[model samples]
Structure formats: C-alpha cells, structure tokens
Target chain A: MKPQRCVAEGLFEWPSDEPTVSGSRCDSCSFVTFPTQDACPRCGADATTPTQLARTGTLWTWTRQRFQPKNPPYIGTEPANEFQPYGVGFIELPEGRIEARIAGDIDQELRIGMPMELTVVPFATDADGTEVLTYAFRPIEG
Target chain B: MDDVAIIGVGLHPFGRFPGTSAIEMGAKAARLALTDAGITWKDVQFAFAGSYEVDNPDAVVNFLGLTGLPFTDVYNGCATAASALSQAANTIKLGEYDIGMAIGMDKHLPGAFAADPVQYGVPSWYGETGLFLTPKFFAMKIQRYMYDFDITPPTLARVAAKNYRNGARNPNAFRRQELSEEAILQSPMVNDPLTQYMFCSPNEGAAAVVLCRAEIAHQFTAAPIYLKASVVRTRRLGAFEVHSPWVPPERADSPTVDASRAAYEIAGLGPEDVDVVQLQDTDAGAEVIHMAENGFCKDGEQEALLSARGTEIGGSLPINTDGGLISNGEPIGASGLRQIHELVLQLRRAAGDRQVPGTPRVGYSQLYGAPGTAGVAIVST
Candidate 1:
C-alpha cells in the first residue's frame, strides 16, 4: 500500500507561527507541483515525494472586482445576491506554478509579470469566532 | 496530421433548459448526429464527450446505453465541447479509427460556467471568491485591454448589436430577438463598462459532430465538410501567473492567438483564406478581441476593422453568422461545437436566413475557456 499523507496533519504542521507550504517532486520528470500531491500535474508521474514550497512567489496577473462574487469565496458578505466588484488573479511561485485569489487594491497598476510574495491572511470568521486564515500573494512592497 | 472530415453536426437549441440535465440534452444531440451521419449506433468506433459539471466518466458511460457506442468523457470548463472534438479528431488522425464522434453538453446548476476556487483552494488567510464570477473575471481582462487600447463601451456595443442582429435569424437561439445600440448600452451592468446585453446569459444545451478519415468521408455523406485542422494550447506563460509588463516583447502571445496560429499552420491556410469564422462570443468584446487575435485583423484593430465593415455578413470576412453567444446564448459544453456547426452549416450552404453569400470555401471556429485554454478547428468545403 502507498503511504498516506493526511492534509489535516500537514495543515497542523504548517500552522501559523510556523508557516509552511506543500509541493511535490516528481522522480520521473523532476516536475514539481505546489500544494503537493502524490502525482505530477505535468508528466502524470506517480513517483512523487512531498516537499515544502517557498513562502514567496511572483505575482503573475491580478484584477480587483468592483462587485461581490456569488457564494462568497473566503468570507465576505454576499452583496445582496447582486454584483459586488472584487479582484483576483494568478501568483507564480518560485517553482513556476500559480494560484488564484481575491485581490486587495482595485486600482493598483498590475502588469503581466511582477515580483510578489505570499502572506497568510484571514478569509472569514465562523459563527464560533474562529478566524480562518488563507494564503494570498501580494506585491513584495506590501 | 491525417485527413479528417466532419460527416455530421447536431445541436439542441441553445437556451435555458432548467428542465433538462446535461446528459439528457447531450443524448439528444448525439442521436441527431448519428442520424445525420446515416450511421447506426453499431458502426461507431469510438466517442468523446465534454461537460463542465457532469461526472467526467459518466458523460461517456451514460451515452453507451443510448448510442450503444464506446466512448470517453472530457471536462475542460467552457472549452469542453471543443476539447472533445479535438480528441476525436486526433484519434481519427492517428488512424486508430476511421470514424469517431464527439459531443459536449452542459447545465449550469452545479458548477456553472466559472472556474472553481475550491479546486484551486485558498491558502487560508486569503479568502473571498468574489472575483471568480465569469463576468467579473472576464471583465478584468476586458478592462485591461480596454485601458490599453482606449476602447469605449460603444465600441463593445457594436459587437452586441451585430450578434443580436445575427441571432435574429437563428430560430434555435435564446435571445433570438433583436437589440438596438441604445437598448444594449442601457442594459443593467453585470460588470462595469460591460452592460447586461454585453454578457451571455446562463444557457443550457448540447452539440455533437461525427468525424471520419477524409478518404472515407464520402461514405457518410457525399458533401461532408472536412475538418482541415485542430489546435489546442494553454497559457502557462506570462499571461496568468505573475503581473509581467504588458510590453509586447515581454507579453507572450495570448492562448487564443497561439491556438489559431497553430490551426492555420496545420490547415495550410491563413485568416484571409477563411470565408466564414465562428468564434466564441461569451462576452460582446470577446468577438472583437478574437477577431483580431485570430488574425481577422491586426492587434487592437478589431474596433476600427469591424467598424469599417470588415466583419459583417457581406463584408470581407463574415463572423458569427449564427448570432453568437450573445444572441444564441452561451451553452457551455455545447458552445464550441455550436460555433463549428455554424461554420459547417455555412460551408454546406445550409444556414438559411443566416447564410453568408456565395460558397464559403473555408471556415474556422474557436473557443476560449478556463482563463487560458484555447481550442480551434478549420473546416473546408
């Protein structure tokens, strides 16, 4: 049987005050995927090992919505079931992969490729007052 | 690439079919394609189906009991149908099978037409998926393009006006009605600068095509339209990951441009060679942007090119002759083939009220999906 890797356990190890990220190193193609997995998304290689990804990445593309999104992504209130603009785009990691998210500034001048860094931020709070934090990439200057 | 011909094309009218499941709608299209090809279910060699929300595998399995043919399912967001056609064409090109079928169908209740953030996941601190809506996401790209090119809402309205006029002739279209510039311009704002009419409504439908090796195309139909080429690509370059300078040298070719270029290369043709082009019209500006990006015009020239009568029905290169997603409605999985089916119909001289004048010797269809996946195919009479 293949060894099991529980995400919950991994999340615990990467908890705040001790930040960590996930990735996979493919033995066959040497391809790596962040938010690590047992197989490579590039070459379909199952020969993979879990590894930690860099805490920082480059901002690939970004846009802010002037409206709100349906189902509310992280923790913003639904804008009356109507449009509430927001921003989102890809963030390229040092490993050459990307992730999407809700953007901060709407009018910030964004280019195609730019240097950025990752930070753990709060998404939304549950009824229990448990503030959930998620990852977001921002301009390094921020 | 081996020669391949489209023996038949079929579609369930594009509109809101909240009453129908994607599988049911897909089956209807598959059955029609089967009949149109003059082939019974038993003669099929292989099949491919596409959908955004349906189970990836069951999309193929559910059809087995209907068409009784072996098949596989594909899911690639909005380009689902086009991807299915590409797979089927590739299978035929490889000589693995002389005949193959591809179908795409979608209903929006489950995943709708936007990319799923849960699938992409939030890193924990970064929350709120408000920017993920289809309109908002595309608006970002459109806004950037508009800012770079000095585009106005009226310029975008021109595309909507054209598509609505074209859709007026499409009996199966959803907003088959007409819209004036003022009406389109005044519609509620889905995305700022992108009015209500500029956006495609949630549509549900399906489309299917029967493909065969070129040499044997005559067996299915004496006048089968040949699928001259197919191209697919993803924008893993500077377009998505980081904010690179929009400078030409630094900015790589967009996925749509790259896919169309590859397709034209494969077909040994250029945009000028294409008599009719059916491109994705999920958003009004999409048609204009694709027209230029697909080589119908130079970059940032779609506004002027289209305004100067370059893309009308009787103009040099008529596009989206069957109304477009704006008029016909964006039917997700069915949209890609719907574009191809329109091109095929035009090539076959079967587009009645919406027909382009003269014999359309060559045609092209394209689809844009999932922020970066672009698929294209060239068809010839």
Candidate 2:
C-alpha cells in the first residue's frame, strides 16, 4: 500500500486511523470557524484556541456539480473526458456550517437535514505518485 | 455636497464582438456618451475606468484624445462599475470636478468565470477539491433559499423566462431571444437547481456614463437623471457568499442588504418610491433572492410576486427592463454600468420598446460581486 498525504498541510489530520479537521474557537465570543483563523472573524478577538471540528453534521443545502471545473486548480488524476460530476454543499455541524465536497455516488439522492459524517477521501494523485487526500461529507449509515 | 446628475449614458451592445478589443469597445461607448452629453472628451475633467480582463483601462483615454486628465483604473470583481460610478459621483459631489466620467469594459472567455481562489485570499486546497465552483455556490444558496422560502423549480424558471422575454425587447441585449418557461426548465442543468439557460455567460461589452453637478445639469440635457445615492459594501462575518469556505451558524446580513439599506437612507426614499429597478441577476435564483434582499418584498414572497407579474414592465414594479445580465451577458466591469445605462434611459423615457408605462421618476440599480462585495445606486429624474 502507498502512503497518502493530506491535500492541505494543516487543514486536517492524516496518516492516522481517525482524521479530524482543525478549526479555531474564539475565547471571548465562543465563535468557531473552520481552517483556523488567526484572529476571530466575529468579534475580532485574538485570543483563540485550536479545536477539532465535529465529525458528523446535517446536510444544510446541496447541489450537483454537473460539469467539470476549470483546470490549474481542479487537478484530477483522471483525464478530462473521464471527469464525473459530484455533490457539493454546506453541512451544518454543531460548531459551524462548512462547505465541503459530498463524497458518494453522484446519482445518490441528497436531502436537506440528512445526517452526514466527515471523512477523508482521495482527490488526486500527484506526479510523484503521492495520493492527495481531502475531507468530504458522506451520509451516515445506521 | 452638491447633487450630481448623469448627463449622458452609452452602451456598446452587450455581446460577443469577435473582431473587437476591450479598448475599442470602451472607446465607442465613451464617444457615444460624450456625443449624447453634447460635450467633447476634452471637456471631461476626471475619469474612472473599471475592467477585469482588460490589462489597461486607463489606456482608453488615448482613443478619446488625452487632455492630461486624471484617469484611474479600478477592479472590484463583478462590482467594478459600481466602484467606478461611486467615485465619479463623489468627485462631482465634492465640487472637485464639474464634469466626470465612469466607464467599464471587458472581453471575457466563454463559460463560467475562471476565478483564481488564491488571488481572492481563499486556500488553494478549496479550489483543488472542486469546492471553489462559483455556479455551485449560487445553486446551493438558491437551494437553501428554496428550502426556507418554499420556492420551487418552476418559480426559478419563471424568473429566467421573464428576463429572457425582456431581453428580446432590448436591442443591446446579448441573449435577445425569448425563452419559454418550459424551454428554460428543460435546458441542461449546470448545477442542481440552476439550468444552463438560467446562468449568465461571460462575454465582451462596454458602458459609460457622464456625470455633472445637478445645478449645472441643464447645460447638457433638459431632463438630467439625478444621482440621489451611490453606495458600496462588503460582506461581514457569518454572511453566506460566494467563495466562503465556512460560515457561522448565526446568519448575518448580506452585502446586498447593507448596500441597499444605505442607498435608500441616503436617497431618503424606500422601495415604494422607486418606479424601476435593476437588481443583479447573475443567475435566475439571484434575482429572486435579491428582490427580497433589496427590500422590495418580504422574504419567501417571491413566488407570489413573480406569479402576480409584479416585476414585468407593465407591472407595479418593473425590474431589469433592459433584460439584465441574463439577457446581456456579464462583462464583469461593464455589467453594473450597463444597468445604470438602462435606468437612465428609462428615466428619460428613451427606452423605445422596453419603456415602462406611466413615466418612471425614480430608478434603482444594485450589483453583487464574488466573495462579498455589493454596490447600490438610486437615481431620479
């Protein structure tokens, strides 16, 4: 098996059995944000603490990306002709609402208020054969 | 501060011009506005140029015969024209210049605007994972709005159909052909809720407006449209907007809401005082949402208002009389100015086939940009 690397360095924990996204919580306002803000976006308070985000959430809203995005940034391992559409939306977790790629079968029906769980997914393989991984939300199974 | 009025307005048809460059298109609009204002370019004191794809908008002064006037280039994503217009109006209001011009021009590649997230302060990983899709953001916003407001797909289709119908009447519109609601609904889906026909394409075009103090306005035209208010705002924390990777669960007012509120306050008028409006319709869903954001209607009332034909040219409130961005493909920098051009024409009763009945006295225009910027302006005859 090949070793995988997180798509973004400090975005989420990787190379472990369980992965969680890193976030920032304001000490003064109790406001939480994703991707770790240096200063609190809400109250502009600098006293913040690094916190791990909730793994499960509810689907707030969603849409199917029926077309291939422009390249340069949307680099995929597959050829352009083989590009497949996917789901994307904001998931309402206890801490905050975060936009994420919804990982699953593209044809799967998505409904608002449905339970979703965050997990690591393969995005693409770089030229060096390192598997690029990103976080995505999937429907939580019973 | 002295009041400012738009002495002249011009638009070089909003569509693809294969053989033309952005500079040529912009120059044409500038010359037309100068001619309409009955003044030469030499008489212009200061100028502000807005553009996205164009390398040098200030270079347009060369085509108009440079008189060593101060020309500044500005870019504010989709709100480019709003920023230009606001600054131009301010120059005249502060008694700095008697006559000034605001112009915007752009030639864009076809399809969805390919915006660089990193340039906009967004992380590269967001774009790499396909989470940076602009259309998807619109779709999700509309989708959530629908869930909250009980808006249906048919209601969204109706908005597109109305804009297309209006576009068919405007000669300057890019997609001038009228599309039936069925046709719009049946169009290929770009995002889950928004179809291809509902989305505006990025194309080439230019628009310009010449402004002068209201007290000296009669020197140019008999009926000068007054610039009552011009305001621009950006989104605050917790506001849902394009390119936001995360949002606090507690909602905040969008830029559209704040800009429109300030514009109305400055103009000393509410939505009822306006006879015509030009809200940003980057997509069909956007128009529906902006109508409420601009305080034209209560939230979730778009379905009834749209069904009642309230937004039609002959309806109680006419919106996008010149077909809007849906009809005139978005030229980024040029889009907001194009809205002003249409409003000016409506106030002057110069809108031939698309003129709203019962002499319109007040006109309003608003444009929302990527990430979080918004601009709003109110004009009166």
Candidate 3:
C-alpha cells in the first residue's frame, strides 16, 4: 500500500500527534487564513508568514449535510449507495475560525461550542493509489 | 438630477417553459414592458439586461429589433435585476436618457445552485470536501441565529407556509399551489434545520421594467410609481455570506443593512411608511434574518410576527406578496424584477387577487446574493 498524504499540498500535515492546518498570518492586521493565501483578508497587507493553526478549537456553527452534493466539485470517493451524511462546521480557533468537516461523532451529537481537536481523515484516493487525507475536527472526549 | 420612475412593468410567467429560450423570454418581457408603457421598442433610448446563463444578454436586443441602441449586460448573482435597475435609473438620473429599460431573465436547471469554488475565490478542495454547498451555508447561519435568538424550528415552517400561500395566489408564480405548514416541516431534510420545502429551487423566468424621468412618467401611464431610490452595496469585512471559507469572530452586518439604510435615506422614508415589501426568501431563514437587517423588525421578533400573519397580504406589512423566490423559483437575474413587477401591480391596484388589502402607497424590494452583495429599490405613489 502506498503512503497517505494530505489532500492539498501545504494545507496540513500529520507528521506526529500534534496536527494543525497550515495558513498565513498577516503581520499588519494579525488576521489568519487557511490554505495559505498571499494577502490579508482583513487589512489587505501582503506581509504575512505561514503558520500552523490551533490544534484544538470550539465548534462555532454546524449542520448535517443530509444529501449528496453535486459532482465536479464534490470529489469524495464514497459509493453512491454507501454515502454517509456528515457534519460541516466552522471551528473557532484563537486566530479566527476555519470551516472543516466534523468527524468522529454522530450528527445528533454535534453541537455549538463543543470542544474539538484537529485530525486527519481519508477523503479519496489519488491516481497512483495514494490515500488522500483531509483535515477534519472530531469532538474532544471530555 | 432627474428623479426616476417606473412607467411600466411586465413578466414572463416564472414557471418552467421548456420550449422557450432565455433570450426569447427576455425579448418577450421587453416587448411586454414596451406595450405596458404605451410605447414601442423603437422608442427605447438605451437598455440593460441581466442574466446568468446567457453570457451575452445584449443578444436579447436581436429579438426585439436592430434599432442600434447601446445595450449593456449585467450579471450580479441574485441581485442582477436590482443592479440593472440601479444602472438604468442612474442613466436617466444623469440626464443621459429620458426613457430606458432594465430587464432580467434566466433558465436554471432544477436544483440547488452549484458553482466552482475558484469562481468564488475559494480553493477547489473546499467544494471537493462538499463544504461548498449553498444550502449548508444557510443552515449553519440560521442554526446559529436561531440558537442565539431563541427561535424554534416552527418559525421557519411559518415563513415557508406564508410565502407558499402568497405564491399560490399569484398567477405568474412558479409554485402556484399552497403548501401546508405541517407538510413543509415534515418534508425531507436537505440540510440541518432546513427541510426540502424550506428552500427555493433555481428555475426559469423573465421580468422587465421601463423607466423614465419622474416628470415624464405621467406621459406614459396615469398611475406611475416613482422610483424613490435604488442602491447596491457590497458586503463589508466580517459579514457572513455564501461561498465563504472562513468568517471573522467579530461579525459585521450583511450588505443588506447598508443598502437598506441608504435606500431609506434616499427615499426619505422609513419601514413604517412602507405599505408593502418584497424580500429575498432564498430560504425561509433569509427572509427572517433580512426582516431585522432591513430594519423591519428587531432580533428575535420573527416568531411572534410570523405567527400573527404579519407578513401576509392582508396583514400590517405584507412581504413577498408575489410569493418571493419561494414561489417564483429564482431565475437569478429576473428575481429582483419580479418583486418590482408585483410591487407595481400592488401599487397600481391592478393585482386582482393578490393585492394587499389597503391602497399601498409605498413599495420596497431588496435582493441579496452570493459574494455578499445587496441591492435595494423603493417605489411609491
């Protein structure tokens, strides 16, 4: 089996237990963004540096995607018959908040303000059979 | 500066018309608007057409005539008509033209609106992970709103039911049949907190209006609804909107707030003075949230307001009197103009069955859409 890798290059990496999504933090406004963009969203300053986001955050808002999304954009490899509904939410990190898929808990168990930690999950397989991993937030066990 | 007024308005019924192309529908609407204004196409000085699927909306003029008038195409997501109207009004207000036209038409496949993430300035993986869905954006926003405002799910049901009921009465409406509140609540859940019936599908339609200097409006029609104001505003930083990858913790008001405030100031009127309104009901929650954002009500008042049928045609301040997007089936560009068409009909007392009870002197319409943009228009006797 080939080794697993992050879905997008430089989005996030799980080298060890400490996992975080990589993004840019603006020096002018201290604003943070995921998938690492060039300019600050708040201040439009290009002076920014790459930084890993918070490892844990609270659920800001969430919803269960009860239906399968249209394709071309939705690249999940789940079979049509076996597709599972999932939770999607904005995780409130100290730097700001980032949208991510919610995992490890049933849809009903997800709630606003719940503690969550970053983790990696299988999204799809690459052409070379490499497992494509994406970052998701699972509920933190109390 | 010349004050603008809508001399005439028309609509190509907002349901599915399989054989009709979007441009054909647009041409039909333009011709209807011309006839309604008691003028001919040759009389149009300039025109603006709005559409999503039709890249060259300027081509619509080919069907109308080859009079060689300067034509412009506009595409502003759901606020396309409002943008078109604002530009057309401003053109006349600028003393450039006395008679101009604003029109919108669209034929969308039946489903939730889908788009490439790159088109909206987001990463491809955002959609690949299925987080780019439009309905989820509404659901999450409303879930948080309801939680903070102490609103129950039943309030959503009431909003849907009221709009559907109003749609049922409007012949041009796409969904011309009333839906029970119980059935709406029991429909299949597409996203958390929003059922299938709670959302409006993108469908086909066209709407158009002819504008002239307010002084000359009476030459075309005896009952001219003066275009008191038209304004469009983009979302400020921290405002939550569709296709957002992230939102700031310190939230800002949606663009509708600014547009609404500017519109009221320009019109020199307040919500209380407005006799009728048409707001975006992309989903039930949108209408509810807009009521507060537009200053029609305060936070957490929708539950009581909707229960009393406050937004009904016979109520204090009717909203979505033409069934809104919930009944009209959003045709992107045409949706805003459809609101104007309904308002014109109501203000003129020509809306046979769906007219508001009183002689509504003031009518308002607001359109909000993707990338966080808002357009507002106010018309009155």
Give the top-scoring candidate (lDDT).
2
How many Å off is the CA of B151 in candidate 3? 1.2
| Per-model CA lDDT versus the true structure | 0.71, 0.91, 0.88
* lDDT, model 3, position B378: 94
lDDT of 3 by residue, A33-136 (tens): 77699998788898889988888999988888888787868876667776788888889988777889888644458889999999988867766788878899
lDDT of candidate 1 over B39-130, digit per residue (tens): 86667788888876677634544654655565888877667777888899889878879988888887764222443455644232222423
- Stretches of model 2 off by over 4 angstroms after superposition: A27-30, A45-47
The segments of candidate 3 whose C-alpha lies over 4 angstroms from its true place after superposition are A1-3, A77-79
Q: Report lDDT (Cα) of residue B104, candidate 2.
A: 97
Model 2 CAPRI quality: medium
- Interface Cα root-mean-square deviation for all models: 6.8, 1.0, 1.2
Give each model's clash number.
Answer: 35, 0, 0
- The order of the candidates by TM-score, greatest first, is 2, 3, 1
What pairs collide in candidate 3? none
Angstrom error at residue B118, model 3: 1.0
Question: Fraction of the real A/B interface contacts present in each candidate?
Answer: 0.18, 0.74, 0.72
Superposed Cα deviation of residue B379, candidate 1 (Å): 0.5
List the candidates' TM-scores in order. Answer: 0.77, 0.97, 0.97
Error of 2 at B82 (Å): 0.5
lDDT of 2 by residue, B262-349 (tens): 9999999999999999999989999999999999999899999888888999999898998898999899989999999999999999
The pairs that clash in candidate 2 are none
The deviation in Å at residue B154 for candidate 3 is: 0.9
